[model samples]
Target: MTTLFHNLAAWVVAWAHTPYASVALALLAFAESSFFPIPPDVLLISLALIQPRHSFAYAIVCTAFSVLGGMVGYAIGRYGGRPLLERFMSSAKIHAVESYYRRYDVWAVGLAGFTPIPYKVFTISAGTFLLDFKRFILASFVGRGGRFFLVAALFYFFGEPIADFVNKSLNMLSVAFAALLVGGFALIHRLSKRYGQGSARPHSERIREP
Candidate 1:
């Protein structure tokens, strides 16, 4: 897995150095926010490191296209619903995400946008639940912009060193992200359990009802 990501990251860096890098980056960001698993951070970092002066521009493109792609995911969930979600993700995964929507709502969208827990899930869930459009857009913008621009800033200033660090720590980052995902699920479960217990009636009350 490490080798695969290293190779992929290398490919992204090399590709970002080409003349058509901007278009490619835009497309990549768009796809990632909708269906693609690979984040645009790879290309954003590479392009920024290579052309530090253009880092902000790279971030802008990433943020814009990513949000646009999120809209596509929203449309899919809104129009296609669970059938479409099942085509990509499992029913259980979708259910967990739905619970998250019930618990966190719009903030969940922002968290997914900036985190490695798969923004696509939240984007689709937003539409699935028919969340307020304006709030969703606002959350996406803030989250995506903050994340992409932070990457750009790091690359723009630290340059090659930061890129090298990210490349080397890719595996660690994945593990950390996974840990976070598990933690989130555990928290949700705990909350649900508590809520269930609190909402339950006493045994005497149940007998009286009968």
Candidate 2:
């Protein structure tokens, strides 16, 4: 598994230097926001590190495609995608998604977008719960943009030094970043629970009117 991951990472790094790199990054970003398991950041970081001159452009492309993918997930949820849930997800997964959406509203989507959480889950849940489209787009833009841009800037400005640091501390950094992402979700979850006491609605009950 470790060897496979290392080889995959090496391939991604090499791909970043090719013209196809941008295309792959865009697709990865899109999938990351939908149902894909891998985060786009890995590609974004690799591309930015390889070509610092176009870092910001890559960030923008990543952000735009990711938001578009999020909208697709949301649409699925909003328009009878709930039935498909049983096809793709387990009952336990569906229940957890419903619980989160009920408690946090659209902010849950934003939290997932920015953090290490699987963003597709929140996107689907948001649509399932009939969240406001305008608010959903706004949250997706802010959260996804903030994360990608921050990463792009870091790699753009301090490529080698940061690369060395990451190489030396990859394991620690991964754990720390994962913890931070979880902490962000935990904080939002607490706040949402507090706020939801008054008027929270479950996913199954949040159908939009025609």
Which lDDT values do the candidates have, in the order given? 0.81, 0.78
Candidate 2 clashing pairs, residues 3+ apart or interchain: none
Q: List, residue by residue over 10-47, the lDDT tens digit for candidate 1.
A: 77667786899999899889998878777888888778
Candidate 2, position 76, lDDT: 78
Q: Model 2 over residues 81-122: C-alpha lDDT tens digits? A: 678656767889889878867876776676667766778888
Supply the TM-score for candidate 2: 0.71
Which stretches in model 2 have alpha-carbon errors above 4 Å? 1-14, 164-210
Question: What's the CA error at residue 88 for candidate 1, in Å?
Answer: 1.6
Say what the RMSD of model 2 is. Answer: 10.1
Task: Tell me the deviation in Å of residue 201 in model 2.
Answer: 32
Error of 1 at 6 (Å): 7.3
- Model 1: per-residue Cα lDDT at residue 38: 76
* Steric clashes per prediction: 0, 0
Clashing pairs in 1: none
